[model samples]
Target: MKQETFGRFEVGSCSRSTELQEERELIQNPNLNPGSSSLSSVVNECKKRRPINFCQEEEEERSLKKRRIVQDTTIPEWLVNVMMREEINGYDPKLILAKKLYKSDIDKVQSRLSLPSNQVVTSDFLSEEESRVIYEQSVLKNRTEGLSVVLVDPLLKKHVVDLRKWKMGGNWNYVFVDGWNQVVSTNTFKVGNVYHVWSFRSGGGKLCFALVPPRNSSDSGHGGSSSGLSSR
Candidate 1:
């Protein structure tokens, strides 16, 4: 019986060692998340996120409106159809899809500053396919010149935001913005911090926009915007 017990202990030790090794491999794997240096913080962020207030703009400085909230906590599970190198569109991965960020899923939102690639990117925090679909429905089908995205807080119940069409020079990457110059002036963005951005169209006005902070930013005492913080 003692020998059997010892054998069981040996098996358990091997199992734990294997599990630890697998986790280490996952943490080191770049494809799991090309931007993150380590996975411990990310895994914890995935396990839990802090809350953010949508209505009140977090900062008085308009320049620092929205950039860099919490650490990059976006999960691999949030991605769809993990593509190998062979399945990409261009030399860069093409048509990579991320799960939509609802008002609640702010933690999963990735920073524009953290994006590793720029092909088929959008002005809003949307994938290329997503922005394209909205464009088709709002502009092409309606026969309008163009319709932009506007973001509003559900609590505020306000309408109408200025929308602009920005070109990516010779390239095809662009995101819609209400305050591009203002965001540029505020150099308050960190590369690892995550931010949530969304747009709304209401009462037949131009595209309006809104921003959300990471769930963890509330009590972390970080020097950043609680209302609108993002690394753009």
Candidate 2:
């Protein structure tokens, strides 16, 4: 009998016979394949450790873009002023002023103001009619003291004319009331008309004046109609 050494395993004459018999048995049994179990386990571990796919990454990016767009909307300042003026006057001064200043040419006027096209058409701040009113009120206020008066309406077209202009037969008038009140009376020169009067009293003091149209008649009543009162 011969002895042999094969890698880590040694076969002596007595053990060689037993080893040979064992090797022959293993060859006949197909189930005894070497490393097959370990190879199968390695393959399953690799499958479980695979990387993520591409579609999920794109979905996250799209969601972020949508959120950013929603956060960027805002309103302008000029429109805010127009809204406030309208609230104070109870009329759309912006619209009336726009008409007077632009003479019904809204597009030309908007271009001059350098307003955006979308703003001119869709802004809630001021319409063409409201802009016209504000413009007239501003012009009148600048021209003369007590000559131009703004009514509660922001719209200048619906303005209550000063009584002084009418008293001078110039379509309006200026009359002085107590320091706390003023009257726009059409009754003085025109005979029969309603009085549009405004009165104010505050911590400062009482200040009042009257607006009357100019009169052509010789009936010059002086006591009730006097010079404009100084605001104290």
TM-score of each: 0.27, 0.16
* Model 1 residue 105 CA deviation in Å: 22
Q: Which stretches of candidate 2 lie over 4 Å from their true place?
A: 1-52, 74-232
Error of 1 at 143 (Å): 16
lDDT of 1 by residue, 1-232 (tens): 1112232132112234444654776877746663454555544443332223222344544435333221222322111111111221111111222223332222223212111224222334444655565466444555332334433222212223223223334443333334333442333434344444433322332334433344444432232322331223
Clashes of 2: 62
Against the true structure, whose TM-score is highest? 1
Regions more than 4 Å wrong, model 1: 1-171, 184-187, 219-232
Best-performing candidate as measured by lDDT: 1
Candidate 1 structure lDDT:
0.33
